[model samples]
Target: MKTIVFKALPFDKTLLTLALESGVDAVLTSADKVEAVRALGRVRVLTPEELPSLALDSKTDEEEAVRRLKAGEQLALAKGWEIIPVENILAQVPDVALEVESLDRARLAAGILERGADVLVVLPEAAKELKAIVREVKLSQGTIPLVPAVVTEIRHAGLGHRVCVDTISMLKRGQGMLVGDSSAFTFLVHAETESNPYVAARPFRVNAGAVHAYCSLPGDKTCYLEELSAGRDVLVVDASGETSIATVGRLKVEVRPMLLITAKAGERTGHVFLQNAETIRLTKPGGEPVSVVTLREGDEVLVRTDEAGRHFGMRIREDIKEG
Candidate 1:
């Protein structure tokens, strides 16, 4: 999770609003203007006096900055700090905020040491370029390859605990979450984003799966459905495997009649436990949502296959097996 901080110095109302609309994590403004920014939106507003600053003017200054960072202080580097010094400081500190005057510098600072700076302070004049920086640094988590899988079997699994993930953002018809019984193979469980004769459209919900299933989240991690909560971020993926970030607005867990669905993609097999209801659906390869009740053997659906191993919800390399 790369953090974007907008430098709204001198209290420009338009730039403050742009920061909020761009989804920046915080705004760097004056102490007196904090309330004004908050009145417009909900975000972290910090004044220059509230945070410590370090000027990397020389070797001794750089050493002092490293010491301050080692002492556990969140320090922001003054603008015009050279890349070499910035790289050296980043190599020693994990949470240094770099000040950039333009979009090119932001990109360079983000790519420094390959891990990049912990935070970027974009000048207020660069508000127009903030959108691209945020999208690139935050939403670009790479792509997942989705393949067509044939449904091998579907059977009633009796009553089980299911999870309904209500997100802060409205999803589209071809969007949903990736979940599975195992980390190696996961299915694209479609969101209830379409209306039916009996139920109105719930474009903000994806009745994810059973409590024990693995759901793909941001930062290349997986978590059980039971671990989700309000304010937490999750990855919402589309049929083409393009992904964006969504915050959890609420989570609903209850016992419901479930169906055990199994499918085979290439030589690998995978399954997911979904609530047995007419609204529960899995996405087909063509981006169509098919109800689980109507899903039959030989039906083709989309799935993602990967090396099957996870340790503490993060993918790891090991000789392990999962059924």
Candidate 2:
């Protein structure tokens, strides 16, 4: 995850509050103000004196920055630092924090080397842009390529435990969770972002899947629905495969009628057991969601393909298979 550090220098209470509300990872302020910042919220507070400073004005300065980074000290690059030196330092060390004075610079710093810097120090002058920066750099989880798969089978699975993931974030129409029996071929299960006559919209929830199923998570990790709990992070993907992190506010596991959905994308085939209800939906190739109850054989839906191997929820290379 990318870190967003707010430069709360000169003790601006509003800026500190903004940082706290924006979910910034840390606040850089004077030593005396650290406690006050903590009083506002739980975040890392860094004093200028505690961080090794670097001004990449010359070859010697760049070397010092690289040396300090190698020595395990998190060096904060001074503003006006050139991209080449930052890139050079990033190539050698992954913990270097770049001080960005504007949203543009923050975007540039994040896109460096295509992996971005480990941390960004948003200067006080850019406080107004802090929210935007945090949203773009911190909330965005990039994208995944989604493909159309043909539904090969649908069976009425016996009543079993189903997990309804209630997230703290309100989801949009195209947003949902990816879940399946195997992590290698999870289906895009749409969220309850649509309102019907029988039930009002519960935009914060996704009637995900069976307790034993794999739900796609951030950093390419997967966790079983039974393993999810309040405060855990889950990756929410849209029809276009754009992803963002959502905090799990609650998990509802109940005995509900389930349907076994099997789909095939190319030669790969996989299945997921989901609640058999009209509100439970799988996303179609064009982004519209089709209810699980209405899902039929030959219907095309979006599914993600991957290597079908997981050990303790983490992807691993081994001779492993799952039905």
Candidate 3:
């Protein structure tokens, strides 16, 4: 959830169109050109009065920046400002904006305090690297630590409700959703990106697991499979733990024979009940899919472990346990 704004002041139509095509969150333009910018695309257009730009060179200026931010105002910092003053303002609030003239400066602004600034104003001079700036700074996410877990048990769980997650974005072979009975330990369920003799490949779908299981989402949140619906965002994680956000296009819930898979990793045991079929798969250690039907007790697969407490999809601090 990072906000990227392209500064279109002085109103260059080419750069405005480029910003729109680059998927910028907002376009900062003059009041006279707001209508023209809106006519081009459906983007948030801001005038100078709406999001004023300033420079923080002295203590008084830094105090003014801090005061404006504390008063619930969002302003942009001019380029050539020092990092210490920005950090001082950021320590108190998280909504301070920074103007950058290059992709490197944008990355630096985004990595401030390890959480980045709430808003990034892109100058028109950086038009050549706008797409790269958005891709690397906005769409990219953090990585998680994935470990090998040995399969302990695989049993027929009989006819049960399962969920199929259909995302708007096409997923690759090693990317899928992480689901399990416990958030602390979850299995990397592979997407249906492989074509078999019987069925065609579904690069947009993941036969995730049972409807009651917990599936990881962005911002370190989790939700049950049954609760996922169209227009919702789910976290798509690869075997290496790199993550991205995918919008749900549809959800399929059906009664299919399920297999309860149990795996153990360093004394921690986790379970994920998935549909019993050849197409249903889990990711292997080398970033390949291993079908559930072909899985054996000794096989090793990729699994993720994290802090377990969650209430209503948000992480919490409490003494709670799940099987």
> Candidate 2 vs. truth: CA RMSD?
1.3
Candidate 1 per-residue C-alpha lDDT over 1-323 given as tens digits, one digit per residue, 9 for 90 to 100? 78888888878998888779888999888888889989999899888876656778899988898898899888888777888888888888778888877778888888888888888888876788888878877666657789999999999999999999999888998889999999899999999987889999898999999999999998889998999999998888888988888899999999999999999999999999999998989999989999998999999989989888899889899999988
For candidate 1, the 10 contiguous residues with the lowest summed lDDT are 135-144
Best by lDDT: 3
Q: Could you estimate the TM-score for every candidate?
A: 0.82, 0.96, 0.96
User: Residues 103-148, candidate 2, lDDT per residue (tens digit)?
Assistant: 9999998999888888899988988888899888888889999999
* lDDT assessment of candidate 2: 0.90
Model 2 spans with C-alpha error above 4 angstroms: none
In model 3, the clashing pairs are none
Error of 1 at 279 (Å): 2.4
* Candidate with the larger TM-score of 2 and 3: 2
In angstroms, give how far residue 226 of model 3 lies from its true place: 1.1
By TM-score rank, best first, the candidates go 2, 3, 1
State how far residue 284 of model 2 sits from its true place (Å).
Answer: 1.2
**What is candidate 1's CA lDDT for residue 220?**
84
